[model samples]
Target: MAGAGLKGARERRVRTGGIELCVAELGDADRPTVLLVHGYPDSKEVWSEVAVRLAEEFHVVLYDVRGHGRSTAPAPLRGGFTLEKLTDDFLAVADAVSPDRPVHLVGHDWGSVQSWEFVTVPRTEGRIASFTSLSGPSLDHFGHWIKSRMARPTPRRIGQLLGQGAKSWYVYLLQTPVLPELAWRGPLGKRWPKLLERVEKVPAGDYPTPSLPQDAATGAWLYRDNVRARLSRPRPDAFAHVPVQLITPTGDAFLSERLYDDLGTWVPELTRRTLPAKHWVPRTRPDQLSAWIGDFVRTHEEPATRAPRPVAEAAVRSGVRPEYAERFGGQLVLVTGAASGIGRATAFAFAEAGARVVAVDRDAEGAARTAEMARLIGAPEAWGEAVDVSDEQAMEKLAATVAAEYGIVDVLVNNAGIGLTGSFLETTSEEWKRVLDVNLWGVIHGCRIFGAQMAARGQGGHIVNTASAAAFQPSRALPAYNTSKAAVLMLSECLRAELAGRSIGVSAICPGIVNTNITATTRFAGVSDTAEEKRRQRKASRLYGLRNYPPEKVADAILGAVLHDRAVVPVTPEARGVHALSRLAPGALRALARWQPPA
Candidate 1:
């Protein structure tokens, strides 16, 4: 208990090349290491939160790069801040720190730029297991885009004004004769955070920016050399072989996200994430940032003997296979109304993850196609059956057959449903029954049959029901669809409460308008085959004015709910607004239902 991980970390000083870097060593040295590199005007203290969390599993190495923090900055610092020079500094640090093993590298802001260059270098290629770039662009691409865009008057004016024009005061003072060193060592000693606020526009309460004479000049020199193209450069294509993860902060005012638009083209193994934070995302969102890093490291950074093929090589040399959740592998997954759209996709996601998928749909061939995709994704087994989930006997028999063949059901996705688009007056009694039968009754049947056995056996399981944004906020044009989905939401909530003491979990997936075959399946009061009639139907659908998301994204959300035990999974931004509307003003929402195509 005394050596209870990083609760007892040791601090030390190490020489990386010419610089004496201050380093903190945490966790067991035998575990895979995480090299946390700090950015400009900041120190390794920024990674305190992340280090503490990762220390339970990883050997965390936090170091102040070069001139920043407690590191010694020798004379003639101008030539030492180039990207190549920074790469040398990182390589030196890694060699001194973890000489025997490949390390997982994570960096933010200026450190991200350094990590991007360091990981792709031929000499350091095998030394690094994976790289996580936070709030930094690919240097070559950023340089190219900036240079190309500066040719235009408007953009050049904006770029120069923000990057150099407004910063001339501080840049001048940093390059000044006598004032900088005296100012830093004297009255400006404790005012580095406030000074950075005025110059970098970072708020005082945000990330702390440490300052020193040599460090300021060395840090600024990176941009100076970049603008002048004075640094040794590798072709942008060099990074294509490296495994890179990018986390972009949407609220980062200084950097434009457009820099990563063509990122996939450069690094084929790129895993991109967008966080809702400022430029100093690592300091502000350490928990989320560290979680992503942990996942990347755990997945990729095994021992050298078990060194997984770089994702880039695995992608090109062979076909990339879908990775499955632990609950899905070789286990039975039931998907209802699997003939088309999200049902088809849910079956495929499970199959791709190596589950024995049972795809049931009223349409025989459609169900077969879903089953086929599961097989293509290397599922342990896949079965396609034509059965109406609303039919109790058919669902019971389907459940029995799956149990007989695949042991027990572990995951059940109730995605079978039909959509109706018309006002309450326009919707007939018969139409209401049909929609309810498929959407509400279908989920009820699946849960009752499969869930009973799962609860009886005392084996934990998951249930996913496909509802809609309309469930919470009724759409003016689709009363029947809204009512059916509303029932599904309540059903899931009630099931979750009943099964809470048991190990069973339930989720209601509320999706916004998805670009699936659902709209095509909407049955008009009278059937039409004429071109004009079809054109009018298409036009009405267009007037509905919904953002059509892809089926895959919705499927991902569904799977995420099961894996994470999330109660209500809302797919789109529209769904979020609907949930808020229902929460704040129910009366207003009900009144607005009279409005045509209420968004």
Candidate 2:
């Protein structure tokens, strides 16, 4: 049976544990099955976005848990929502959907909690090829964690225990007899959707369904049935048999990052991914979830002949810094002007963090060299593309090719720019146009083309635009350069505000003066002869050499900005000083701008 507006989805009802489960299927039945599970107080619609994405390559399945969505709640639901019954529901669904093939299990929140149980139990070993867990921990693992911390009673462990205890305040309330049900049936249920939208930045849609009040009321037993029982008498033998991937939202308010500290002891084959998102990732970040789940399932699926796949070099590389590896690993990153200067260094930084890098530059050889070194540095894959960022059509083609070949870019660095130096009176219109085209319009094109893809993907990504300290610290000799960088800085701030709701981060990296080749090629507005221009270039390059700030440091700042979601970052000492001065003492900066540098 299919609802009229349910699109191409096929719906079925399966009787499991005396409850009729509402199940929906998509894509070809012959393909491997990917079963997506929703969390508490939510229905199958929670996975609608992610399910469609996965359906492109796999047989996608989604079902309401025992009492949520269209599924009928068990009579006298107090003890009916145990992990055992949940596992039974999973088995029934798997047997009905793909009896001969194991399913790839992906779950978020309470779904993850139950799926962890499914993966660890011996009965479901061959039925589950892999499991991807998000935002929820196994109650058994959580309980053991609590017991160990309490048993040890050390200061650090106590702090962790207390921190997690604070986060789990809702669990305590949920366990109370009629209070939770009454609240859910009252104003709380009606307001929950708005609350999720405001707090988690989840886009409004047909989620939390009309059945939310009853679903949440009946689902309270999920905590009552399993939490205390599993925690107090935890199973020591609860270790996962199938491959497991953990996707952690760094900004989740309900779960502490420290909860997974001992996860390795339980999961033998584990891959960890961290996202700069809030709790409801399936709703707010479905694209990223689907991408990760697809990759994990494809890697672990049983080949027709049971042949082993070769381990990838990126998987085994120890070059990535430990802090960055979890966040950037397997992510696609594109850097413009990556042939040299800060762009190349930034590309190398992301590559070293295990991202797949696409290096773009007008110089083909230099771009190729950067890509080659990026592969050696630890990128899972790297490519070089020769494109001028100032050309709109070239950038559009580049964006299409990158998406078709490398998947959507998770991080975009609009680092391509040029240098121009001259007084306002002497700078010709052509010189101003040249600088603005590359510096301002280049950033605009990158953001318009690539940033749109990121937003349309609905996964959320980060964009880094290379501005200069001249954006803030006005200078007499660098009028055109300052104006272009100022526009870039303002664009970044505006984009940051606009994209915050989309979970896309925009950062303006303003480095004062770095040891880069921009100075060697900087245009001198008033110089008429080639020799004079060369003399000016050498003089500027020599002056910058004396002040020598490495581009590598600027690269480090770029990565840090992405990690911290920083808006405007000043890299070098003088940059930071000038930024401070521009804000704290604007008149002083204006006075300093009046001083003319040697020609």
Query: Which of the numbered candidates is closest to the native, going by highest lDDT?
Result: 2
lDDT of each: 0.70, 0.89
C-alpha displacement of 11 in model 1, angstroms?
Answer: 2.8
Among residues 3 or more apart in sequence or in different chains, the pairs in candidate 2 whose N, CA or C atoms overlap within 3 Å are none
* TM-score of each model, paired residue for residue: 0.50, 0.77
Q: So what's the TM-score on candidate 2?
A: 0.77
lDDT of 1 by residue, 128-211 (tens): 988888876657766555554565658645565355334235534554555665665666656776665544333344245344
Model 2 agreement with the true structure over 343-377: per-residue lDDT tens digits: 99999898878778999999999999999988877
What overall lDDT, based on C-alpha atoms, would model 1 receive against the true structure? Answer: 0.70
For candidate 1, the 10 contiguous residues with the lowest summed lDDT are 314-323
Model 2 regions more than 4 Å off: 2-6, 303-318, 329-412, 422-425, 433-463, 468-521, 530-557, 564-599
